[model samples]
Target: MTIKEKINKFISEKKITHAEIGRGLNTSQQNVSRILGESGKVSLDFVVWLACEYPEIDLEKLIRDSDHVSIVRESPATYQKPRLKEKALEEIGAVLDKYM
Candidate 1:
């Protein structure tokens, strides 16, 4: 299913009017109507906002749109913090030292 189609289906299931969804997303009701009806496109940012807003919504289904998925990753690099704060440093160090 396309992304728009998925959203439309969910909207149907939720029995929510476009106005309500738009209100939740801080957009106009007519714009929401256009988005649902394929008269306008829903931006990736909007999709992200929707996902963040409705955490319980099935993302796999909700994000399935005709438009290609837009994955916005913050960063790929790893960051490290002292495990002492997590109180697992000793346990972690023991495992790592064993492997080494």
Candidate 2:
């Protein structure tokens, strides 16, 4: 099914209102309506936020339906301090190398 269709189905099945989703996303109800409406565009950041907020929703399925590759490296809940530090170091090193 198409992304819009899937989202509509999810809305119906979950009995969730646009306002509820808006509240979760810290957006307006109108924005949520627009997001789920025809010609609505989904951003990777929005999808990631949704996936993080609602873990019951299958992110892989959402990504597939949206015709996008799943780029989520790992769930935020599973990110360890060491991993974060390592990533920070890598990013810092990359930036330094770019200048040097």
Q: lDDT: which candidate is best? A: 2
Quote each prediction's TM-score.
0.55, 0.58
Model 1: pairs clashing at backbone N, Cα or C within 3 Å: 2-64, 2-65, 2-66, 3-64, 3-65, 3-66
Go through the candidates in order and give each one's C-alpha lDDT: 0.55, 0.59
lDDT (10s digit) by residue, model 1, range 2-100? 767666766676677878777888889988887767577877556655555444444433443334333222343132333222223333344446554
Q: Where does model 2 exceed 4 Å of error?
A: 65-100
Which residue pairs show backbone clashes in model 2? Answer: none
lDDT of 2 by residue, 1-100 (tens): 6656666676777777989888878999999888888888765445555545544455445445345433233444443544544443443355446554
Residue 2 displacement in candidate 2 (angstroms): 2.0
Q: What's the C-alpha lDDT at position 9 in model 2?
A: 73
